[model samples]
Target: MINKIDKLKDPLVQEARELSSSKKRIFKNKIQLRGLEQLMWAKYAGLKIESIFISEDQNVDDYSGFSSPTYQTSNGILKKITETNYLIPCVGVAEATPNNDDFDDFVLLLDDVKDHGNIGTIIRTGKAYGINDFITTNDDFDPYIPKTIDASRGTAFKVNFKRYKTPQSAVAFLKEKGYQIVATSPYGKSLQSTVELDKKPIALVIGNESVGVCNEVLEAADHIVQIPMHTGVESLNVGVATGISIYELRLKEVLTMLAEKIISSLGRKVSVTSKLIRRAFDIKLKEISEFSGDQIIFLMVLKRKSQMNEEQIGEQFGYFGDRLEKFISPLYENKLIKKEYEEIEITNAGEDLLAKLWPIHEKTENILLEGLTAEERKNLKSYLEKIQQNCIKIMKYEV
Candidate 1:
């Protein structure tokens, strides 16, 4: 339900106004959200709304249905509550989003970044590039402060932040957790993009606006990198530099991650090898025939079976319905197969096409098994067949 508060003296209004003070916010354990976007984002992040105060001119219908109470008040009161010259349409009082210790593969370390706006912008940029965990040296820094929230465009709600007593302590903790510390500095010899990265987790240290990364953290870092700049230009803004660094460094991490997954994951290896084989077959078949590798396989299946009903053909190649019809229609039009009722049989033309395509298949297989001896090839086939049977059994059990 919506209620009317005509005076600034109302208890709810006074409480919300008090939240403008940092000490009061902590004492009350609530944060004052200034605009509708902040309120929407806070709700989206599952923050509990203690109350909402909307300007008297705003449509009450727009503010209704929230589980928390909403009050309509004059613009002057809203201006007073938010401490801004211009009126904000809505103000929200919500429980401060709690911080968690959980860290991801990519994290941002803010070293003595005193400006709330910079912190907010870094968080916004970091979140955009898939870095959600932010570490800071300031124990009392509030991520939900109105200016920071405004700077972040409410993305602060989605960010997870943790505080450390000092940058050294934070580096120690991350190092213990197996994170590779990469600190940014203007004096560094290596460019940000050139830093070598592995598959281990990364903690990128963005330092103070005036001073770069601290000496302690720099000494501990696995790589000290900088963004190249023109000779006259001294440095980029902390937020801008952090954005650039995060993007470039994250890309390197992603490449390292992909390489590691390709090397270590059996499923990934099989999928990649299958794709390469298909691609090679497709290229080789194009030189010898008009049919695609899959289409030729379909023709070969018919030749092996002698004849198959439509349903049985679909089952053999995992194609059905319109897809199966689409696959068969072209071959039928070309007179490569004969259809009687629901049954299909390969024609002389289909047999002739397969004969021409068979050598390309043999050549592709030979290229794939170039280094393998005869005995090794036989054992490899046996192993693959066993793996395929195991997969089939697992699928059957699950079904």
Candidate 2:
């Protein structure tokens, strides 16, 4: 049942107030909320709403599926959303914990960054670029504040973050686990010139706005990095600096993601092209015979169904008249084929060469037909042949 407490001294109200404050910290599973936007976003993220408080005149239909305890208040005491004292139409309390997964090789650490708004922006920007795990030093502002949530537009609730007692402790633990510490500083090498990211499993530290990274923390960094600015500009906003640094540090992942998108748009045709297949076969079967692609393909056709005369061979393999003669004469001189009356047959030497190259040819076939069922492979071959005939028709029509 959703409990409604109108009095300011109610125990639930006290708990909500405490949960909403930064100085008095309680590691409760609940978080403070404000506005319809925050409540809706929390629900969209699939968080469990513990309870909700609404104004006396507001209809409950706006919050349909949530079956939590609903409270209607007239004094607007429960409606004081945050320290800003804004009386929003509705407020909610939802489960604050996110579905946290294992951390990636790259991590973002905040060192004594006391601004709540800056912390929220950092979390929002970090999540956008694939850095979900964040660690905060003890002096850093609490991420659960209403200002933080408002600044992030409720993205703060969706990110994975942990608060550490000190920057040194966090850096020490990360270093022990093989993460290189890279701290941002105004005096450090420019981000464009930094080569530390060539090494993986890096922890990028963004510091307080006023004091910057603590001297002790800066001393512990494996590499200190900075973004270059124009001569008159002294520094960048912490949030902006962090965003740029994260992009530069994760540039490899960003490029790989873009390449995958391009490849996906073009389909897997890149892997199974005619040119690539021809090159692979040439390289794989070079030892058996010094035959070109046309010669090898012609020999394979005869090997499967022998005794093919000139016109019949042309019909079967698309070789005609002079082209057919060119393919056969070279094989005849090499003792690979014999002329038996009107029909041509592969000679003993040809059979020996085919036997030597059979395994490689079959392997090449398997590579081309990979990830397909037997039926699909047959259908694909039929489709390709149809496409080839269509191409021939289009060429003849143009001529």
Candidate 3:
């Protein structure tokens, strides 16, 4: 329900205005979000909204879906609550950004970086490169400040961050977790692009605007790297430099992952490719059905053979014992499949499910083989069949 508030003296309005102070925000465990875009992004990140205050002229429908109490107020009250002279469609009070301890393969470390704008920009850039985890020195730093959130374009909630009392402590933690610490310094002998980065996790540290990386972090880093610049230019902004470094490092990581996937042994390559194909199929299958790719594949096998015993099915799919039972239970419970004595068969419902799912299978295959010619695809299938037969023969010999 939307309430009408005309006075700045209202308790909720005063509370909203008080959230502008960092100290009060921390004490109340709430953060102020200004404008529609920020509120939308906050909701997308699953942040809980306590209340919303909007100008009387703004549509109440836009704020309705938040499931929070919204109040329609005068334009002056809206400006006062958000501390902005310009017109803001709405202002939201949301739960403080939650901490995320799950670190990705790459982490960005902020060492005494005081500029909220730069921190936010780094976060935006890091998100672009699939780096969502960050570590920073815990002092007076607040990543959710209004300027930081604005600079991040509302991505501050999408990322995860952890804080350490000092940069040295953060570096030590990363090292203990088997991460290779790469710190940026203009004086470093190694160029950013040329630095050796393998498949190991990395912690890339960006430092303060005025002084660069702290001495302790620089000395502790596994690799001190620098971005090359024109002779007259000393350095770039910390945010810009971070963007360039993240791009180069992420590109290298992708190339490395792809190279390993393709250039490994034949068996490994086949295994990885099979996993990738299943992952792609699962993503597409989710849009149309609740079943997983493997479950659908099981249904397809039953359709092909009409019926098969447990032993026969095991031979084809390599599932047995509890694993087999766990896989089959869902289908049987859902009435998609039925059992007759020792034989298993697909029900009419299963057939219908397959009819709906076959197009997704074909589409996923086409997407995977997008650039390959028909002849190449045929040859590829033939090669895989031969490899499968050889593997079966070896398994039979071992048995």
Candidate 4:
């Protein structure tokens, strides 16, 4: 008669069982990466591997960093590892534990946000807006899931996130120490209301899209804020609303550097309330009409396109002879802007220069743009749009 337990008798399984029972171990800790489980007993966890295992024998060492384990299995171990005739060989025993501390800055707490996409997009938005820390209710979608990581587009590694069995406790801790707790809700006040943000510290909270913030946490929050919606649209996607909110807070409160965004959003036209630094740049030029730098008077146009031809420049500033050219030329030559085919671009040099004299640029750009490389922004926006679609896809059912 065939043995009922023959499969379990493979020597490889025997080895794993034996090691699992051992006690001696060593580890490293008491530092920033202060709470890792695998490292807690690195000696045993590190060396207890029975043998390298693989489903099928093939080359996997193209990038050895992701390769090493796939290449070192004995023929006996291979058969035993593959319980089924079809092999299933990849295995490692690192305990999944959230022992990371770098998640303190602007941590996002997701309270029962059920949709996986919403969770993913919120994470992407947090990363975009220079927020690198997050905490989720115990039931929030799994951050370690491959789909969630894919949604983050590598941002998962940059940010620190942990799952909390509860967010109410986190809220209480934050409120006690003066962190502003703002919640998202249909019933919240207008979006443009002034937020008194402290440069010292702050936290913005988001709730489940379906039911809104829990009453318990809602009562616990310092304030409940909302994003104003158009008459037709019901509400913003949790992720989109979060991105816009964070954008406003970071650009306005975090730093005053990006005056252009405020200008750009006010309809491709420039505004008159000149940034303090720009006023300083052309302080003397205000005397003449051609150089009439009435920053306040012209709310519609701010900087004349630097790349404009003499005619275009003349249209904005009355064409003047060599004297005026000498004056306007400096604005062009400094690389604050460029004129080509009558178009202009504010260069990095220009943006930095604007940032120095004004404490605004660093805070505005750093926090609003967050740590997003240019490419990441495109991917994030695209991903957010995709998430919005999936949400809408699901949302259509409710409507």
Tell me, by TM-score, which candidate is best. 1
lDDT per model vs. reference: 0.86, 0.75, 0.86, 0.52
* Residue 107 CA displacement from its true place in model 4, Å: 1.9
Indicate the TM-score of model 1: 0.66
lDDT of 4 by residue, 1-399 (tens): 111123445564454323321121001101111112221222222222223333234344421333122333444544443333433334322222334654453667778887666777888788877887776665333553334434655354455655566777767766665566777677876453465544434577778888878888888776677777779999788888888878776655545334544655633332342354346434533332133232222211323233445554455555557854664565566655565665545456655554443343233334555779999988967976886698679978994
Query: Which regions in candidate 2 have their CA more than 4 angstroms from the true location?
Result: 1-11, 23-26, 79-85, 98-101, 139-141, 252-399
Cα error, residue 1 of model 3, in Å, equals 2.6
Tens digit of lDDT per residue, candidate 2, span 1-399? 334567767666666666666565336657777767888778876778777778777776876667777777644575443444556777777777753436677788898888888988998898888777887778434677777888787777777777678878878877777777878888886463454454447788989899899987899988887788899999899999988888887874345355555666533564447668877788777756678665777777888888788888787667787887776788999999888898888888988888877787888789878999999999988988887798689889894
- Ordered list by TM-score, greatest first: 1, 3, 2, 4
TM-score of 3: 0.64
lDDT of 1 at 398: 92
Consecutive 10-residue window with the lowest summed lDDT within model 3? 253-262
Model 3: residue 328 alpha-carbon error in angstroms: 31
Model 1 residue 385 distance off true place after TM-score fit, in angstroms: 25
Model 1 lDDT tens row, 1-399: 788899988888899998888778755668898878888888887889999999878988876656788988899999999877998989999987667877999999888887889878988899899888988865666777877888888888887878888888899999998999998888787889888886699999999888888898999999898899888998898999998998898789878798775677999889788879877788889997777777888788889888899888777667799998887888989999998777789999999988877989889889889999999999999999999999999989894
Per-residue lDDT, model 4, residue 394, is 90
Q: Which of the two, 2 or 4, has more lDDT? A: 2
TM-score of 4: 0.46
Model 1 residue 89 CA deviation in Å: 4.2
Clashes of 4: 6
